[model samples]
Target: MDQEASYGFAPTEFEERVARAQRLMGQHRLDGLLLTSMDNIRYFIGVDSTFWESYTRPWFVLIPATGAPLAIIPEIGRAIIEKTWVKEIRSWPSPRPEDEGTSLVVEAISGLPRRHGRVGAELG
Candidate 1:
């Protein structure tokens, strides 16, 4: 799809949401948040893609305690994500079941500055 047209929330709105989440994370002593679901990802980064309905691959966005989120996604979705405000993105070729960006995810998580060494993820 053409990402030429901007989509989703204003950049400031997304920034405010991240700030609120970070404040909450500080109260809970969390170092970061790793989100995988489409809803949560959209809520934070404004990526709304019907392609996500396929479920053939995974998508991730890592929101550290005090900065912009990093989108870890499949290469196919890069164009869509680029239209959003997020500036840092990492992608890998999709459908490689043997790897499927697991290593990249690990690397992204490991690179965070963690005082609590605790990362929150969507569960249940």
Candidate 2:
């Protein structure tokens, strides 16, 4: 069993949260949501980790208008993140001050459907 499975939210609970977010996204006509904060990511995907303490790596959770949430994270956290409900995970090497998953994030956002898709990000 995965360590996260024991402590994280149940699969159904995660699904409910995702459904609620998707509903709101649809109401607002958003193509997707970009969640960079640890709290927001955990809320959406149930990925609780102390590893977020280090600023060396940035983690992202992209909640599309439909379907499951996608996690864009560092390779170091892959094992732990895999334990969460998020199934579509994209990983990159950490501490890469130059890039730091910037391109990966851009690509992920660009892949969303709709030529003029609107993606919402949590700035605060």
Q: Highest TM-score: give the candidate number.
A: 1
List lDDT for all candidates, in order.
0.87, 0.84
Residue-level lDDT for 100 in candidate 1? 69
Q: Give the per-residue lDDT digits (tens) of candidate 1, residues 1-124.
A: 4442375877678889899999999999998999999999999988799767767788889999878889998899999888888899899988888876789889998999979989999997
> What is the lDDT for 17 in model 1?
88
Candidate 2 global CA lDDT score: 0.84
| Predictions: Cα RMSD each | 2.5, 2.0
Error of 1 at 110 (Å): 0.2
What are the runs in model 2 whose C-alpha is more than 4 Å off?
1-4
- Reference-based lDDT, residue 55, model 1: 70
Q: Model 1 — which ten-residue stretch has the worst lDDT? A: 1-10
In model 2, the clashing pairs are none
